[model samples]
Target: MIKRFGVSMEPELLDKFDSFIKKYGYKNRSEAIREIIRERLIDETVKEGGGESFGTIVIVYDHEVGDINDRLVDLQHEYTGLIIFTTHIHVDRRNCIENIVVKGKNSEISALAQRLRTIEGVSSVKLLLTNYTYK
Candidate 1:
């Protein structure tokens, strides 16, 4: 079942939304609005920290930095149940990037990201959570 509702906004906002629709190639306002709502709901659900969520933790680090590689491997080993798989990329001779796919409670994922950020050589750590259902 689908329910339709009305949204009232200022002309300026509507103009900007129209432009966004065109920029994103949305077929119409309804499609864009639906996506926006869905994203917001998913974000809220993930933020609540109770439900299981899927996300990727991406980290960039200098491998040569004191014991970083060993520490990184050790930390990841501790979260074997949460981690689905990890893809490591050698960005250069000294730097590496790892994209870790994980599925667990929001708190667990967040905790893992926090731990990754504290690693000595880690220059960047990013966690992006998304809804697990794919249609």
Candidate 2:
């Protein structure tokens, strides 16, 4: 069942929200609001170490850096239980980008991302954590 309700907001706040929805390409306010709620819930759940979540860690680094590739391989092997897959791309003669897909408890995945970020030769690192569900 779907229920409809009314929201009361100041004109300035409402205007800002409308602009946000438009900027994000949300089809309607309801859809945008629902997404916001979902994302908030997921963030809370992940922070609480509630359940398994999926994540991807992207790393850009200089391949020529001393033994970085070897060190990365060793670390990945140590965390084989949490890693789903890894893809490597050569960005240039000296640089490479790696995407590592991981699935496990949020804390574990976060630990792996943190470890990668601390590596000596890593130029950039980002981790996208999600508890997204498909139904």
Candidate 3:
């Protein structure tokens, strides 16, 4: 069942939302609003789950750190069932960025990303996910 209700907001903000809807090619305000709500629900659901999740982990680090590359690769291999693919790019003379896609329990993926970020050379890390189970 779908329920409809009026939403009050500042005109300025509403204008921007209208522009966003136009840019995103949303058919109507209601459709755009529904998508936003669904996305938020899925996001919150993913965060609340202690079980399975699918997401990408991005990291920036310095390749010059002692054996960091090998260590990183080995660590990912250790979670072979979870790590799907990794894309690597050499940012500069010493810096590098890697995007790793993984699927597994949230705790497992979070722990893996945390461990990688704690490595001596890692400078940044980000995790993005969208996994929800109705059951």
Candidate 4:
């Protein structure tokens, strides 16, 4: 069952929300609001670190810097249980991008991302956790 309720906000905030809905191509304010609420709930669940979560860690790095390739390989090996697979792309002669798909406890996944960030030559590391869990 769906329940409808009234939400009151300042005019300025409502205007901004309307603009956001239009920019995102949402059919209406209700649809956009539903998605926003779902995203927030998922984030909270993942942050609680009580259950398994799935996510991808994307990293960009300069291959020429230090022994980064070897370090990255070793780190991934250490978390073999958490990592599902990884895809590597050669962005340039000296740079590479890696997308690592992982599934495990939220804490474990977070730990892996943190370890990856500490490796030398890593220019960017983005960890995107989702609510999906594999059985």
- Specify the highest-TM-score model's number: 4
Top-scoring candidate (lDDT): 1
TM-score of each: 0.87, 0.83, 0.80, 0.88
Residue range 55-82, candidate 3, lDDT tens digits = 8999999999999988998898889999
Q: Candidate 3 overall Cα lDDT vs. reference?
A: 0.86
Steric clash pairs (candidate 3): none
Q: What is the TM-score of candidate 1?
A: 0.87
Off by over 4 Å in 1: 133-135
Give the C-alpha miss distance for residue 49 in model 1, angstroms: 0.6
Arrange candidates, best TM-score first.
Answer: 4, 1, 2, 3
lDDT of 4: 0.89
Considering lDDT, where higher is better, how would the candidates rank from best to worst?
1, 4, 2, 3
lDDT of 2 by residue, 99-124 (tens): 99999988888788889988999999
What residue pairs are clashing in model 1?
Answer: none
Quote the lDDT for 12 in model 2.
100
Model 2: per-residue Cα lDDT at residue 66: 90
